[model samples]
Target: MSAIACASLSALVAPSLCRALPALAVAPRLLTAFPTATRQPAALSRRMVTSASLTPTIEDILVEDHRQFGEIMRRYNLATEKAEKKAALAELIRQVAVHSVGEEKILYPILEKIAIKGDAKAVIARERQEHKQVRDMLYDLLDRNLPVGDPLFERDVEAMYKYLAAHCAGEEVSDCPEMARFFPESARREFGKRFLAVKKLAEDQVAEEILDMESKINL
Candidate 1:
């Protein structure tokens, strides 16, 4: 009779123990389902560096510009009136000018040294010429307050935009590859440092100029 009673008690207690053990184990997991904080965004300097000694490539710079330029183009396309178009055009010009300055300050000299004549020089030179052409067009757009549908405004800005897109694509595919192939590891790094320094300086100057101009225009 005593043995029978102990068996009966054991059967009842085993199921309860199993359920309690699982509940205890799973409690912490359930509690952790609440939202939690995350790490802050990475810094720009930290992002571009891969290895301790590796240099940033022209491809990297151009790729960044492509992303930024695409956004500006989208904004321009969405603009409604002359005022909106003008604002978009201003932003586009500002971006292109800053980008050109950065490339000239940092990228051009490096490519000019490594690239062979005819193909390389012409390619790089053409990009510089495009920059000048676009700058002139941008100046015209800004100086003259014309309707968005006007032929002059449409022709100049669209031409500049098309030229810029093609130029950027060529740099990423052809010129940048040549630059990377020609330079030594150390040379690449040195070039990258110089480019970054000059790029920063140019960006600051562009920003200041834009702010002053905007202030004058009350934009």
Candidate 2:
């Protein structure tokens, strides 16, 4: 009889055995769901490593950053402690600022050039407006210096999150993919490198500002 049938029979004939029967029935499914790991030959593993090390394109970099930013926001939302939430919020601010600036400085200019002429100005303008709204909200949050748990702070953070989520969705759906089509693979890779460099520079600037603030506090 099938394991499920056995389980049903056990339930009918022996209630105490029914629970154990279900476990027996589920065991094979659990094993199938998660196969046991096995060591591969060293040479095969090394080959796999080489294959995995291939460089990512511009789209890959942007998409990965979006994913990371989403994760930071998630961490901020899930953080129960004030200190933990503050830290997560600060990191999220830095990342959002850097990512927006990098796109504006490096990515958007290329996009503008490659974009269809009639729509280019309008698209770039709209994206810039969205970025401006986010930055304005961020500045307001920073200026308040309120505890993360404060009602005002929570409200502003939620607003910022909603705006950012919408902006990211638009870029992922329309902007990045359209811009990517205009560039050759080699040029796209180069753009990716430039994007990272610009983002790093922006992050450094934010770090310096943070250090300046902390130093003032210590003084």
Candidate 3:
């Protein structure tokens, strides 16, 4: 049985389980230098944390991402215009797709370097499975070939919203916060920096590919 995406999102290892379980946050050590990313336009980089940020931990970054995901979904649901809805859904897919991978590749694996409980590894396994489900849903969203105005397009987008809402909620509650329980503050910050780098790298490459794919999506 797979735990659904918190974005596992976070609940699998709550504070009560902290002492008994292991940590799953990103960052094994302080990164001597922040990773480089090509600069992006202000509009495209709406929710990203910059290198200039004085002090935001990785938890803050992930939480903010969850919030952004929700907001994009709401925008998609509320949008009356085709263009409006299309943009919102495209952004939602891009953010969730990338963030999920970031956690898998950067966030959780670093924590594996430390001594972790069997349950924690199990939680990570579930999260990885959840990520697979999410990826499948995203591909389904695209493969449906439904344009913004089609009723079926609305149906699929709504379905994605519900799934992601559950995923984000679980992560914010348990997965995100427990990251701080075991790791030092520097590790958290380093993870944030690394995650942001991933986001920046995706800006032109992944986001554009998704936008182009969704625009042409029509049954």
Candidate 4:
């Protein structure tokens, strides 16, 4: 949203509806511009590398993402102040939301195309369901309809933390290794490069999500 518009909003509504824009904040309602679960960069390239590889595979990259998620949670757990915890949670939500885009759009489809384990479809379905649950929990935490002081807010945060930890463990042990088994080093690296590129494209959306959730944390 334009500065004048946001200033007017701040004047007319609770400061919480439109706080001072953070360094990463984009236009107001930018989060609403993209669909909740499917927000992604339209121009993300799908090219594959044909040559032998010298770098990490998609499995490696996915593991790194899991590690990052774990670290975010770790810090959130350590945080004492409400502002600190909310800020960390906003970032965690943003990272998880964007990370799902590359994994679902780019990585999971290979398994759908050809599966030696015969459970690719079932696995993808389960993973997608879990991703939806995480997204929903974040929305519940910030939903304006809920009592601003509701105890459910704390319950949802703790529940999501446990749920996300288990989800990451599943991907780290099972899904990521499946990526390794399915693709050779060169192909894996090529797909990994593409996934990373798409993630970069989602940077603005990530920032918008963080700002949106942060603004909603009135507690």
Candidate 5:
């Protein structure tokens, strides 16, 4: 989305949506343009990194997660049939788990190595704790056989989604610059490939776990 569209969106939406819309609108541009405002010329030159050299920094990846989460929330709100909602919730659970694990496996370690004081390692550390808590809730949801909208499951899923949104914010504001610093061009290209490979492995692991659960249930 363009700046004009964002400005238009801000005028018409509630404050909360207004705040969130910028990331939704601007994220793709940020990935491509890597705007000077969010990144420093020195950082870019020091790294000699171009947009194509990296797939997406943790910020970009998390922005995509937020977009997906927002879509799921919107679908859940609009769903009328119990079956449909349940299916949507199941899909949401799958996506969120995959996203979280991929980030933890591929992104956080890099952040921990490069993070500096003003870069908000404290916030990122707290967010990592939140990820563990949220992952526990997701695992509980995975183990349950209950219907969708079961109070406990719904509560846990909502909590996890909320945590993700806040977590994404911290990463974008606090940890993004560190990414530019840590992932200079050659390193970014190599890490980008590794990140995707790890994410694919994580997805396969989730599939295997689901299969194991299904076998145990004779389903």
Candidate 6:
């Protein structure tokens, strides 16, 4: 299955929705295992090196990240334990922040250059605005360290999901396909490598910030 199609299916069976179905007993375990099979860029690179023929494209990397984010969100929403919820939320924020930064720095710039200049600029601007909104929500969630059951926490989580889902839909339907048309096969693979590097840097920075915050809270 295509990465995008897999992600869409995973999102449908996410804990929140699956809980209402007859398969609820197995859903959690299935959902938990689903993320383990996702393709990370490092792993993809290694496979490509071994095969020397099948390289992942930039869209593949992005779609994989989106799936990871969706799975993390599902974990957060379904987590009954405080620690589980906290970990899920932290990872969700980290992934979303990393993906947004990578897109803005790497993908959107390439899109702007290759696409019709005016239209690309407008699209990038709108996407950036959405990213800003998501970042603000994430910062508030991280800064407060509120209990998962808190009303404010639930509200913010819902809001974050709504914005993120909309943004993902837009990208999958419009931006990614359009951008893919402009890049050659080799360039797309190279871009995937760069995107993964940027994502790792972003994830490390966010992890450090989270650790620092926790240290201060403990003090």
Over 45-155, each residue of candidate 6 has an lDDT whose tens digit, in order, gives 233333455546777767666778788989978888877877777666556666776776666666555444465566656666677666666566656867676888788
Cα lDDT tens digits, model 5, 156-186, are 5576566666656545554555555444544
Q: Each model's TM-score? A: 0.61, 0.68, 0.69, 0.67, 0.61, 0.68
lDDT of each: 0.52, 0.56, 0.56, 0.56, 0.51, 0.57
Q: Pick out the ten consecutive residues of candidate 1 with the lowest summed lDDT.
A: 18-27
Candidates 4 and 6: which is better by TM-score? 6
**Candidate that beats the other on TM-score, 2 or 4, i.e. the better one:** 2
lDDT of 6: 0.57
Off by over 4 Å in 4: 1-55, 116-118, 144-151, 205-210
- TM-score, model 4 to reference: 0.67
Model 1 misplaced regions, further than 4 Å = 1-56, 81-84, 148-152, 184-190, 207-219
lDDT of 2 by residue, 138-173 (tens): 666657776667888788778778777767655655
Q: After superposition, how far is residue 35 of candidate 5 from its true place, in Å?
A: 17
Model 4 agreement with the true structure over 33-128: per-residue lDDT tens digits: 111222122111222223555445666667677678788878877877767777777777777766776666666565455443445466555666
Residues 1-219 of candidate 1 have per-residue lDDT tens digits of 123222322132111110000000000111111112131111222345577566664445556656688788778778776667667766765666666675765566555544444555666666666666655555555467655657776775676677667666555555545544555445545555555555555556667556543332212
Instruction: Give the local distance difference test score of model 4.
Output: 0.56
* Candidate 3: segments with Cα more than 4 A from true spot: 1-55, 204-212
lDDT of residue 216 for candidate 4: 80
Clashing pairs in 2: none
